[model samples]
Target chain A: MNPLPRIPSPRNPAPLTIADLGEQGLLQRLQPFCAPGVVGDDGAVLQPSPGQALVVTTDTLVEGVHFSATTTPPEAVGWRSAAANLSDLAAMGALPLGLTVALALPSTCSVAWLEGLYQGLAQCVGDYGTAIVGGDLCRAPHLVVSITALGEVPPPLVLKRNAAQVGDAIVVTGYHGASRAGLELLLDPDRALTGLCPPSPQQRDQWIRAHQYPRPRLDWVPWLRSALAQGQSASASRSFAAMDSSDGLADAVLQLCRASGVGAHLVQADLPLPPGLASWQGLATALDWTLYGGEDFELVLCLPETVLAGLEAASGAGVPAFGLRRVGTIVAGSQVTLHGSDPQEPGRVLSLDRGFQHFSELF
Target chain B: MNPLPRIPSPRNPAPLTIADLGEQGLLQRLQPFCAPGVVGDDGAVLQPSPGQALVVTTDTLVEGVHFSATTTPPEAVGWRSAAANLSDLAAMGALPLGLTVALALPSTCSVAWLEGLYQGLAQCVGDYGTAIVGGDLCRAPHLVVSITALGEVPPPLVLKRNAAQVGDAIVVTGYHGASRAGLELLLDPDRALTGLCPPSPQQRDQWIRAHQYPRPRLDWVPWLRSALAQGQSASASRSFAAMDSSDGLADAVLQLCRASGVGAHLVQADLPLPPGLASWQGLATALDWTLYGGEDFELVLCLPETVLAGLEAASGAGVPAFGLRRVGTIVAGSQVTLHGSDPQEPGRVLSLDRGFQHFSELF
Candidate 1:
């Protein structure tokens, strides 16, 4: 072997790419935010709690398709990417353990951009009591961030989409369609920070924040599990079903219906609309947004009436219960009906309503 | 709600994109190969074995960078992506539980291409006694497959890179440089089925196959762990360390050395070179490939001399022991010295040589 020349190392101020950081250097920079067991190794070791099952989920975000570099900041992109996968865990009523992110970056990307991304990721993980354990870094023509999040749930209380029972009350936590409205505001061509919008600055900020920095609603998981357990004792609901309203309320409900081999009768008046919907010109537009808008990251559940009563009682006692509205009921059929008035009448079929379909409009 | 007009659906023969399949449709297509516990819900639930800790690792593959569409088939891409992460588990002596893949595909991508990719992935997972548990699909301008694999290992026996001690013998499983040679053969512009190569067809095929379908050497993990335990009892060896040589022999050795805060004295002649290299022109070129080429997916272990003895005895007894070759020893210095002959003479410093720096010459 011949002696190789040692190359001069690039300083922080120099034009930098991931290549300059190398795999080890990048790992070193990320070490501070990692959990105790996530040493710089091939895999992160985790000890699952006793009688708990591991829950794993992944989500991918592409540069042009998922977010526009011109509009979305690097930090928000990282934040939302983690948020998406964590929301999956929330739907399962799992306690998040940690996350792993695999990022492919363009060679022209700067070191500052990567640092900002990690900063945002760390913020989200820390806020949720989770850590970013380990990940792979590669070069590509564009940016892609793929996140895999791990969580733990008690085996008996594991929530699934195919567990809904007929006659179950369908409920949702939080308002619907806010994220879609926020997405529209962010993508609007004529919207300066303060121009071409009827909403106040606070309302505008709320919408944009909801779109870019959506929180995974994991806080209500314990409450939901307790309610379900009590329901199983008092009622013959037999099963529990829950999922995230990521692809709009109508689509998520339809998905739950499809998986559970059941149908639903949703009352239009019972659906929770965003408070800012009053600022819009027409109720139809607000309804459309609530029905077909995506990325809300809220939980939709099918519970027995007994469970709903227990939750309402908890709320009466000021136990900070999740504010769930009874929007529908699981029925013995194959189609989901969205009813405006009389239940005896043939209502509008919502099963065919599409939400945010990727590769349809963007790509 | 008003009745919405039903849109005409595109037929199978029509131009179909991922949007037409929809997320649920794509998942249904993939559901056949999933494990028993992997319910089509928000996340895949896994039960860890008793006394076992979970190990998680992730890798990302990007089109036009990690693999070329013109040169590599979609199945090979999927197979190799899973192989890379599984190899990380092999390094840690862990049993693979399952894998989660997050894919971003272009709108123009064909359904046939996706089927081929999953076919390859399913075959690999089945061969390893693991399963495809869950995944997410989205749209992108280019192809990106990010896989996160989970494994299980007893906490006490978990292998790590930072456990090497002074006087530890360095050994590697399988021949080095085959994958690099195979990669070169695949990338060669002039190689028509039998054109311009000095090696036999069998040898050429070996090189290409090694590159495209490298397997994680997990069969020998139990043997290595047992050997280490015996060595500790019989010879009082202080530590043991191992890592996958995914980044070539020289760089992997340097990485282990760095993590253990030790250096190495490696004998150039003692390194294991692939048998196919004899069909090449010069020994120096073969040595360079063995030393600096990456992505071999072979294990490199820093073990006590006593453990190597135990492993050799097992090999003699007809047990499936890895083909181990003693190449070097851990030393109490900061620089790795690759010596040709005389130890006192000037030797090449291997630490300065970089291997497979992504974006160095490509972009």
Candidate 2:
């Protein structure tokens, strides 16, 4: 018997490749995944919320650069693309309204693969309480999935990188290095991160999923707002800052420092690696991945000490799975200094910044 | 002695290629071209005008697919990309607001070329009364410029493809096919257009400029709206439709017909080619380009007869630079029939639709 198509593209049952369906047919298939009555127009029409400012962000994912077609499923690629833009919106404390996705694909790409991508994109967008409003499709050598998400935030509540204040505490949502570990595992199962024992199958799957389809921390916006408000009540004057940790923790901290003209001192004791890595000897390998392995899609926020207490009080002191952790403090300099991070020397201080420059390095 | 890098990257100062400057450095260079105080954050914040609907659109132009890097200058590529999206906004009767551009470039791309691209992008965006509010940069095998534009139009005045009505006159803004002729001339100067003598130097330059830097007809929105409203006053009940002619006049007519469930009949005697093309024997070559050569970036609109008269009366019966030519009329059937368009036979009829499918063929 003949083998069936590998990827599930049940929606585009008739057309085998994108060229076979043509632009109209492709648009017809895509329309249902977008907001109702928003497609089939020159442009989508959206009404901004009363007394709200629009937050706009866009990000692109390329075939070989962002995701390896060999290892990553098409659906995961789509989810990751949308999530990157959504994470930016979340970092700015904005509620996502809609997005416009533009895809440039090679002509020979399978219809089923594109269908899976849209399914993933639609799922991620819908789960975030929004929908794809409009998009464009064109031909190119590599598959470039570019997404622009529009969100809304009240003017007084806008979170910004320049808002970080001296004496503020720096915290991050979710565990770092898990995504980096997951990616290395996916790229080469036999040779994972150095000194990392091959994890259990369940652990491997979870890590890989974290890397492939990292969730945006939009959920933390409300909790952060509430916590910040409570903190403001305790101290009348302060500046709270936040940004997404898409380009590694080191870069995020450095950017926040550069933008706000302040320094960060990371406390290694507060940083946690994913569970099941306990058999490892030292924290050397985990530290590198946590500090420099990018695409974490977590939130690195700076708030006053009062807010950190508010978060613990709001939760049950454990601060449940917003992954609340006080990793550092905002200081008076413009560099990110790590304390007790180097296992070779106790209380070792290593200054690090500018992690993973796109063109200068091989990622 | 080194030809000054062949392109002027004065702002980039010392960076030779995109890889040299990296993401942060490149963004720093690009910041001045965008809206003030919008960059260096997770996202851009825009405040929309009250009581207006947002018109959003996104489009992409790939290196080999949209333009040739060797022949098409970097600046034109940028201008063309912005113009494409801006045309869609104007098609919906929306005022230009701002745009977010996401570029995926090869590591070898020159900083000078990118700087020139931004210059053209900023010029076009600024000329249309807007700015580049946000953008993204990433590595790819080829160059891809994807832009998402946001405009605003009052809900009552929105133009749509499905608003065409029977007995409405179909008119177009500016000339068509000059861009096509220009592209042909640029791609091969000596071999110009088929079955025609070579164009004069001035004419060739004009045609080439049309193709390379096709202007979005945002200037026509006020004129058309006023004309439509005047017609509405005369009739009180009619549907006026519009869309950009990016996919050729035939495709625009077909889309409008398909969306509105109507048909169109073109009157060929009305279309006038460039002054120099009159040296040709018949209308065959010009007609082919007019009917099918895409990327004109003009506006194809449907208006009542009263609106046609209003435009003529308002503009001293000439309609001047608006290029107001009523070349067709909407009908009850579902096919776009060209009347007397076939040069081989007098009064011959030809039905045409679905002009270009990107993935299936060379553009």
Candidate 3:
């Protein structure tokens, strides 16, 4: 293992653990990331835009369970945690506002690790024009970073999982399967890049980066808002539904269907596999990665016929459309079915229990 | 140890671990505690009251560090976590709206543990009319609960630590030493109730409860709002400063003074000791506990003479005044001094390093 790279702190004379930077010192160092007049008070104050309803979500990442200390850097851990929460806000089609972090670290954890973690957090928030606000720091036996992100949306524009209806087009933004593949690359002992698996170094790096820094689909929020507004006219996707693929596409689709009491038939061929997967030696492994790989942080929206047509027409226009794919359609049932070659043939009906169960997966 | 107590869940038919409930099932079980229409969506949506400024605070409690599974019940663990964050809101005189909890528990942890924790959380929020808006649940090696509580306050009525003024009266609501004494009873291996120390069973229980469920002073928010409003007038206590005594009265006083760029002179004789402490054996021990005990969840306010006059006159009429003692005064210098007997003699000046150093205390 490599010795930790030294990250200099302009305030401290090369301190070791966070203990070297006392509570006040730590707060002072992290204050720059906070919104103005928000870091020192008992609680930070925020004023939402007029007629806006605030959207909030929290996600917790623990060492060893969520990420490996050996494989993933502290900064990436922080970035991913923030990204997970931001993705939830994006799923709601809300504009990112601010976030508060509750971080607990072991006494042996280095000050450099803390700095790197905050730097990553700062970078993510900086990109979205969001402030860190104030947060709590404490001691724990291991590392735990919990982030709560707050955003705002016009009340009528809020997207929900229970809004999906029959005949709605199921569309997903961005490519899928990369994050899970990345995890496999990092964890698989027999992988070529680690002198055991077949993948090249560049492929491994791309996959790993996908897992570490999954982009929260904030960029697609404007498009979603525009679609939602037009759909409210009773001629678009007025019964629209959307959710982020954090628990893998299959599981997330099932969740949305179950919530809305509808079924979905997703086409396997239409599923966007991670680039270069065609050269992979195993078909089953790649399929599994595409179908059930969690942490993609991509949006899956159910659009009515009118909105679907509009989106399809606007796809090649000024909109930032990359991996947007029309994968399937909502149906009148409770099962999620997947079709391979032909839609007329029998499809593979998937169960809710097939995907990532956070508790079961941890063990 | 006694076998785990049976806490029946009418919702689940004898579930064992979280996996049995599954993610959706678990969310459904906990949905009753959340605000209406807020739990099922990707993110909870909240509409803050018109003209209100939202206050947000997050606090995390870790197993082995914040509590012992052997000594503290899961309900108390949840209760304390909620209380800690709520206390921060009380310090700001904000009316709590809702809270989102991010819980990471071990896979082997019982379903009953999760139920008990939420039950306690529900009770706290119920008492204040605050809702459990939503939360995240996941797996960890140990229990870690992070809560982000949201509240609202009129901007003009916001309480701040940096608002303290020179010659202002330093007053505290409720006693402080009891919490530290409780912690000592819980942590000291040679304590009487544990068959080694001199304290009785009743005394031990009192301390344990104090440590486990420190009440947030939501009941006092109205009085604070009224005080802050009246103080806004030219003749009232315009230089008001306030914060919670989470890190002992001395430490909290020092923090308020430091933030305000002022000093404080506290009289030891005026410090309110917990009731029945006269029977205790040691004066210095009791004094140390009173001066440096953290987690008391009491409010310490620096009030001007005019505001103090109005508060004193209105105390018993409508306010729930308990242990409201004038312990000291804000001074001109940057030191916190305590006079044991006479002010003419040299006093004890407290340092910022005295209490609740999260990292240093852990080691």
Candidate 4:
């Protein structure tokens, strides 16, 4: 074997290696950003901040599972992960602060792809005035992005799940079912439709944009907080009791009711489906989609009857102009019912109750 | 023709689906232990403290990249992820406080597996007296665990990378090269050793245990702090100028010298290799292995020569005696060298000129 090629070694008398360089290099880079009570002798040090409640939420996006490697852009993937976590913060009426991201990718993944992902994340953090304090990266079989958002809520303004009461008027933000419709079109590209057989470029753009880059409504928190502060009436203040609705309308309403130990009767006719999707059969399908589709990231507010005027005023001032429709009324009992145009025709009301389950095919 | 299974008409109202549960379930489950400023809103809220500094470190573990699916248990995988992050904290001489874990698993993964992983994580967190306050979970092609550890250090005691000066003696906690040797046995079980091979099952257990569960010397922090506190001399006051030797000795020394803007020379004869691993050829073959091995989560300290006596006094008092050895002395230049037994063997005096490069084939 030719004497094993006589491997050459270092001639100097000191000991150093590449591994040390990387570790020390990282320490040098992070030293300036170190803050007290954040880094601990054993791990991360957390000092208690009494009186201020913490709102924590985490979201994960995976290649192939949540996004396709072939279709979804990496930038969009990064944006959506942040948006998903931020939306949870908004639902709690909490102010966004900082985030920790964990990313895993195959060794073969390009550096450009990683950079693009960070660029998108940086943009989102900048838009929301948050800092990317820390994160983890590792080589893996596929791409995965996971983020945990931390927010603060002054005691008086914190929103929660267990506060929705009976007679609360349910309100949803923005039109629904568009995302589900967009997904259908993307998944079945060759399918033909009777009314809008194929969307114009602009229409496709609108749907695709909505599907890919849903913005979290951080601006809504202050409005909700201000409305609650007025103390106008129990009915009015109660309306802002709950604020999350990402899964779907039916499921969200059910959650609110369960939390408040109540039930609800929803008006199926009131849901705002896309205008072009309102044919007789299409309307029914659109309603079903609205009731069970995922990734809408919309807010479902459980407010009292008196807050309707405030909501209408806010809508007029152009707060993203959510549909603000009254889809349901909280009631005593533990079940949900759907009401059609004909009050007497209870049988005509269709209930789409299936919601998104993370690991289940129902999603 | 078999009646095409009546695809549920899109117009029909379906019962509340599981997908509709949304994030509410997760939020409810996590609400109790989640800390404020660590969760919710736009980003996490951090309250900085005076006279203290934060230390943050992140680590990621992938299913196939870091551990084989067949050999590594899920619980062990979780434990290892936390251990790696905690190890970084120990290297900084910072106190461990809290951690955030992000997990990505395939949709088909069993719930029991997830619970087991969490149980392992919970056990580790409990051992460290830290909380798993927040994290994210999502579906992916393979399991990925990313952890971020946050630590804090009092201003007076905060150890740094650039504090070593000329003549500072090098000291290391615990033994070296054993992890690399254990890994060798693991990778090539049939590789027979001529001598130093453990003859009993108990001895074998002791050898492999060091590799699988290398404990972070958290309990030693207070002792180290006290020892360094009575700094009447230059060496005594600056007991630990730098830390973290996971990437191995040669790599670690290079980092210390580079950061301190100095040079160091270690005596090959002073290296503390394990009992069974000490032949001239074995030393030669394993010298590189010990010098370049990563995952040896040991702390390396640069102290003044005056404190050496104090350290010995403390070590003799049953304080988990670190295998303290005078490996080298800091010099005024930026070069690392190794002195051999013979002065004329030019290349025998090695210099660890580079830090360990991660993801390299040698790993």
TM-score of each: 0.91, 0.91, 0.91, 0.75
lDDT tens readout by residue for model 3, A216-265: 98987877777677777865435578999988899778988988999999
Q: If ranked by TM-score, best first, what sequence of candidates would result?
A: 3, 1, 2, 4
Kindly list the interface RMSD, in angstroms, of each predicted candidate in the order they appear. 1.7, 1.2, 1.3, 6.3
How is the predicted docking of candidate 4 categorized under the CAPRI scheme? Answer: incorrect
Over A1-363, each residue of candidate 2 has an lDDT whose tens digit, in order, gives 212113344564465887877777778877888898766788999999888899999999999998887678888888888899999999998989899999999878888788888888988898899999999999999999999999998776688999898888898888778788888787778754445465766777777778877889888777776777777667774547899989888888888888999988888777756766434314677777787888889999898877887766665544556458888889897767777747455343443324877777753
**Residue range B1-363, candidate 2, lDDT tens digits:** 221113343464564898887777888888889998777898999999988889999999998888888788888888899999999999998888799999999999988889889988888898899999999999999999999999988776788999999999998877777888888878777655444565666777777778878889887777766776777667764657899989888788888998999988887777635555545324677777776787888888888877877766665644556467888889997877777747455343444334866865553
Model 1 agreement with the true structure over B1-363: per-residue lDDT tens digits: 212112222224655556667666666666775776464687999888877888999988888877887688767777788888899998987889999988888877876667767777877888898889988888888889999999998777788889988999999887788888888888882442442336656766777767877788777777777776677677654557888988788877888998899999899889888875844735777888898877888889998877888877655664544468899999997789888878788678886346666655444
RMSD of 2: 4.6
Once superposed on the true structure, which residue ranges of model 2 sit more than 4 Å away at CA?
A: A1-15, A190-198, A227-239, A278-282, A310-323, A341-354, B1-15, B191-198, B227-239, B278-282, B308-320, B341-354
DockQ score of the complex predicted as candidate 2? 0.70
Q: DockQ for all models, in order?
A: 0.54, 0.70, 0.64, 0.19
Among all windows of 10 consecutive residues in model 4 chain B, the one with the lowest summed lDDT is: B3-12
lDDT of each: 0.79, 0.81, 0.80, 0.62
TM-score of chain B of 2: 0.89
DockQ of 1: 0.54
User: Model 4 — TM-score against the truth?
Assistant: 0.75
Deviation from native of the Cα of residue A90 in model 4, angstroms: 2.6
Taking the tens digit of each residue's C-alpha lDDT, what string does model 4 give over B184-263? 66675555343454324443444455565566666566666665665534534443576667768787777677667888
Of the pair 3 and 4, which is ahead by DockQ?
3
lDDT, residue B234, candidate 2: 72
**After best superposition, candidate 2 residue B343: deviation in angstroms?**
15
Candidate 3, B238: how far from true, in Å? 5.4
Best-matching candidate per DockQ: 2
